[model samples]
Target: MTFKHSIKTALGGLHSNTSRSILTILGIVIGITAIMLVLSLGAGAQNLILSQIQGMGSKTIVTVPGRQPSGPSDFANVFLDSLKERDLQSIRNKANVPFAEDVMPVVFGSVRLSYQNETYQSTVLGGGSAESNNVMSDIFDIYPEQGSFFTASDVLSKASVAVIGDKIREKLFGDIDPIGKKVRVKDKTFQVIGVLGRKGQVSFFNFDDMILVPYTTAGQYLLGRKYFDRIIVSAVSEETIRTTVNDIEMTLRANHGITDPEKDDFFVETQADLADRLKTITTALTLFLSGVAGISLFVGGVGIMNIMLVSVTERTREIGLRKAVGATNSDILTQFLFEAVLLTSLGGLIGITLGSSLSFIISFIISKFALASWSFSFPYLGAGLGLLVSAFVGLVFGLYPARKASQKAPIDALRYE
Candidate 1:
């Protein structure tokens, strides 16, 4: 028989066993669906993370007061008391860090904010100098919508002035003009000077839920710590990021009297470094989950093989009649192989469609409810790979059944009950 006729015979055979064929492909459909979902979500997560990290500009560097975290369990080391005022000052010195364009010491704490009877728990960020106000404004890409930022005098005098987020304004002030109002923080009351515009999240920090104050005041009064939690530095240009990092590290090491790099207490992370680390983590997680989902495909392949074997046995009398009527063994093998491949390939296509539709729906829900930045990405590569894998599985598993069906003697197959 011709190849076309072989394929036609294969379709007729599958159509006769429609229920069994559908059941056989179910595992393949599920496996491909899971893989597609993982790949699509993984791509979206990576994009969001990289975008957030790079949004701050490639020239940005963060100096934290602890050894570099190697894993999740070492996160507590990030809060270690290492970066002090002297380290901040040294980083700011032009001679010590020539490439450093801007440097600010950041100290933050969660505190209770009160305006008369209304009270809310909010995070307070402290940092900014006469020179650093515009610097922060540039770095965070935020400006006050209603009022103005505090003056240089505020940082120097440790003044009780506060700049609240837009959300804070809505909750506490309710349409009332927040500027020039007094908000209490513990025993200290700060006069509201400015309200940041509706900037939701900047470089992983949510500006909409935070309050900004002077670092000196926060260090002495709010957090009651003299050391800075983090020191932010920006380079003059993207090309100078490495130079600035090296300079900041050398300056801090000198201030701390450390000669060995491995023994250093603090860690410095540039924008590129952070992005690479996060990308690696995301990619690794994606691969791990994808591997787990792959187990289902193996099970699906086994199901297909078993079903095909059973199909050969059930069609034994037909196979004998065909072989007796001019059908060659090669033709019989091609027909059975085609049946297996068509079943798996059809399953792959259905799986791709279902997986993509589900992925899009999930992405929409996540973007609407959880993270506004989350987005959907079609996994074209994954779809292609899934299809290829499915075809390969069919080819490999179908070979044994096809060979068994082809090797049957015409008289013996006819005699089988």
Candidate 2:
């Protein structure tokens, strides 16, 4: 029989047992759907994280306290109080780090901010120097929409002045002007000097929800800590990033009195290194989830094999009739094989539609209610892979049943009930 004739016959057979065919490929549909959804969500999350990281610009470098974490158990390194005022001074000195264009020492803590009858709990960021405004403006492109950032005198004198984010301004002052108004931070009243423009989440950190103050004020009166949590450095140019990072490492090592690089109490990371690390982490997580979803496909393949075996047994007389005429064994085999492939291929199509729809809905919900940065993405590769895997599954599982049906003797099959 011709290939087209076999396909027609196989489809007719499937149509005749519509309910059974649907049941047989149910697992395949579910498996494909899972694979597509997992891939879509993974891609969306990776894009959100990477976009935030990229917003910091390519020439930026971050220096964090504590030894670099080598394993999960070393996560405590993040909380270590290793960076101090002297360390910040060393990094800011042009003689020590000539390539460094800007530096900002940062320390943050949760605080209760209150104005009049309003009270809200929010994170307060302490910036070490007045140049922090320049760093934020130049590298992050963040500037105050109202008033301006605090001056160098404010930081040096540990002045109780604050720059509030858009969200904070809305919650505390509402329509009233917040500039020159006083807001209490940890029992000390600070004059609101500026209001920052809306800057959304960056690398999972919500800048819009936090208040900015001088690191001196925060360390002295708010957080009651002398050490900085992190130090941000911007290179003069992209080419100077490596040199700046090296200078920072050298400066910190000298201050901490560390002779060996392995024993250094701090870690410095460039923007490129951070981006690569995030990509690797997200890719590994996506693959692991995909592998888990593949189990359903394996189960579906087994189901296809079992159903095909049963189909062959039930159609023994029909096979005998076809062979009794001029139909060859190859013709009978191809017909059965096509039936199996058709079922799985149909399942794959259905799964692609369902998975894509579900992914869209999930993405929409997340973006609307959670992070606005969350986005919906089409899983084109996942859809293509699902279809290919479905076809391959049918081919592998249907072979035995098709061979069995083709091998049945005409006399024996004709005599069977």
lDDT of model 2, residue 402? 94
How many steric clashes between backbone atoms does each model show?
0, 0
Worst 10 residues of 2 by lDDT: 128-137
What's each prediction's TM-score?
0.94, 0.95
User: Model 2 off-target regions past 4 Å?
Assistant: 76-79, 128-133
Score residue 302 of candidate 1 by CA lDDT. Answer: 93
Question: Tens-digit lDDT track for model 2 on 104-176?
Answer: 8888889999999999999998874665446556656678999888767788889999999999999999999
Candidate 1's TM-score reads 0.94
What clash count does candidate 2 reach? 0
